[model samples]
Target: MIEVEGVKIDTRHWIGGERVASTRSFPDISPIDERHLGDLDAAGAAEVDQAVTAARAAFPAWAALGPTGRGAILRRVADGIDERREDLARVETRDNGSLLRSHRRGVMPRVAMNFRFFADYAEKLAHPGMEVRGHRERITYDPAGVTAIITPWNAPLMLATWRIGPALAAGNTVVLKPPEWAPLTASLLADIAHEAGLPAGVLNVVQGTGAEAGAPLTRHPGINRLSFTGSVPTAGVIAAAAAPNVVPLSFELGGKSPLLIFADADLDLAVDLAVEQFDNAGQVCLGAFRLLVQEPIAEEFTARVVERARALVQGDPRDERTDVSALISRPHFERVRGFVDRALADGARALLGGGPNTSLNGLYYSPTILADARPGSEILTEEVFGPVLTVQTFADEDEGVRMANETRFGLAATLVTGSAEKAERVSEKLSAGTVWVNCFFVRDLGAPFGGNGKSGIGREGGTYSFDFYCDVKNTVFSPAGWRES
Candidate 1:
């Protein structure tokens, strides 16, 4: 909790291993009921600069710890997360309106697992050198000084740790700028990091609007690497800011990914997997927004999908029975509603839901399905980022693959087919960063995860993250008799 001008708020940013307050504050409202949850301190240029300076000062010592030492600290952090899992999950639910059940059972567990995976990987990591004809060369990896990590409002803690775990494991100091809408959990994470014995100034959290905090952090010359997860337009802005300093960036942006359901797919399995589009209220970057069903079974597949979507429970996010929750804010809720309204206006047919669920208060939109949506419509081509699915039909395998790859965004794609050969062939042709065969959200912690084209910039997760957060330098040692020319 924080106090500003004699008023108390529920959250505060952590910088230099201490709770910090800002002069200006922003209202933190609950999407479930629009109630005032708290006042979040607004971190601007000054705060961002302070956090970066602290990280920059802390980098040398953190890097000197070596991978094993750093891994040990990370392991403790992982354990700390597990110890506070329930508290963390509840904070996340209150901040972002994600269903408490999902947060506890799914998101929070993944957060701890991510830290543990990276910690173990860091200890086992090897940067082997080679023996050349006349010299022995050694390859080494070093942290990239200060890394500025910006995460979105959806799944705040899980996504932030996705970058935080690997960056810290590789020994880079970080300044994390969590979304203002969901800043609570990031602060909690900072507390946990400190309690786990993370060195002072090793990790900092700055909270504010994108213009004030995010833009300055991205453009700060002190930062060595920039890692961001958000929309495509925002990524472009971040890229421009980082350009002047030549700061390398790893972007995990938005997607309108496709799910290809072949004629031979198991109908039950296919429908279940496709319904994952509504998980986290469809705010997931990897959620399948475009469904391409084979023409032969398109009707049956769409019917089942609609039925399942309709059956999903929609109510208070805290309720264990609720399957779907409200959007993060009123503006975002309206924006998602606008996408559906425009689609319907442009001649798209809503097979299930199309607009806000006025029956209930707050920001709730029904799980929507638009059948026979025009290929070029806004809803079909753009990322709705809501509980909405726009579906189309493909005649055969060739057409299915073609249509799946048609979108500019290629973050993730799904192929539901019984034949292994067809799955392999189509997976190869799909231009997505990750392809799931007969699965929806099953992710391997060690696998490379990112998108191609507008979806994202670089890969993360596993050793791939180590590549982004560190610099690999080769040291050459000539034979004892050799001399420099």
Candidate 2:
């Protein structure tokens, strides 16, 4: 156990509202300093089954509580999260090496906001209005049974709750398989849920590798729905595993999002948005990886972005001044490094940082920017998922839209233009789930969020979330009973 903000957090599988020991365990290491934090119990098939069984048993009573009752408990969960904001942020920083300041200022608060928003949303805006002229029609949402949720490591707690809040608010019991790389916060979340009086079996967390824990959870017949946020390969594996059960799946997969900058746009704002890609050391899935700058401003904008990338401080995540920190693990660091190395080898020029930061230990890669990267090159087309951005120039509006849309992934994009007409016209053509105009990472919980193409299979947030968590049914009555009673 590790102590965070006076709370001793146990790194164990939380199933049926209790900590469960496993025959096999894995070491939880801090990416910040490479310290062995604790031995986390790795849940196997048996544990997955146990968690699923518990969720199934709790489904009826949990659903019976209905929206209002469930929302009340979720509100308390949000309060508990808010109360332990410092603790959660600290743990997350140590666990994944995200900057402590970012977590405390934004990530942790957003985690609580997710629960609070969904609780209120499920309580209020879940009903779909329908009108039928010839018959009386009513639509109702019924909670899907046990839901299996697999979250990514980059932003573990926040993403987990993004799925969890809705699943619970929709009155469905959940069995969550957190990414083994950063599983601590998920365990702590279970504690908060229990303290907030969330019933046993209503929320269960099983921690382990994707093959061991995640596969079992996805394949479990007890699960009625599955939601996953991670890589495309992992999603593919999950799909094949869940196909036998034919489990309805909602996937928020990878992205090669583009940041389109026009000449008329605010230069500083465009540079800031470009630099924003390096936030969280560029592990953000929705981050703009490919930068398509209009030719008129390409040279100046690239210079500003390169300068900012060079200035970003890299060191311990606990330091408030630090901008970049360690990658999640050695393998991931190598993966990102490989992407940059290959690009440079293939004649792409590194405008700035191109390798690991020798000044600091561990897996800290310098914020990298590549220029002259060939269009459709691996670095430009693939989801590097690092603090690496590739610069590409577009001659005109049509060219900018073309470059942005020419990708297999369509998760998100950013358009920096002063012209409202250009924003409106270009945004419509961008093949992405969400587009940010003159801003980046600003989110409204009410907006529909997901991706098109290889990015994701379905949307989440607002009614979109409810649509997946609940089985919507329409009840239609024959027109006024032709034979009077």
Model 1 worst lDDT window (10 residues): 2-11
> Against the true structure, whose lDDT is highest?
2
Q: State how far residue 142 of model 2 sits from its true place (Å).
A: 0.7
Task: Summarize candidate 2's per-residue lDDT along 224-341 as a digit string, tens digits.
Answer: 9999999998899999989999899999999999999999999999998898899889999999989999998998999888888889889998988898888998889999999999
Per-candidate TM equals: 0.96, 0.97
Model 2 spans with C-alpha error above 4 angstroms: 4-7, 126-133, 479-485
RMSD (Cα, Å) for all candidates, in order, is: 2.7, 1.6
lDDT of 1 by residue, 360-413 (tens): 767999889998777777888899899999889999889889899888998999
Clashes of each: 0, 0
Give candidate 1 misplaced runs (Cα > 4 Å): 2-10, 480-485
Give the RMSD in angstroms, all C-alphas superposed, for model 1. 2.7
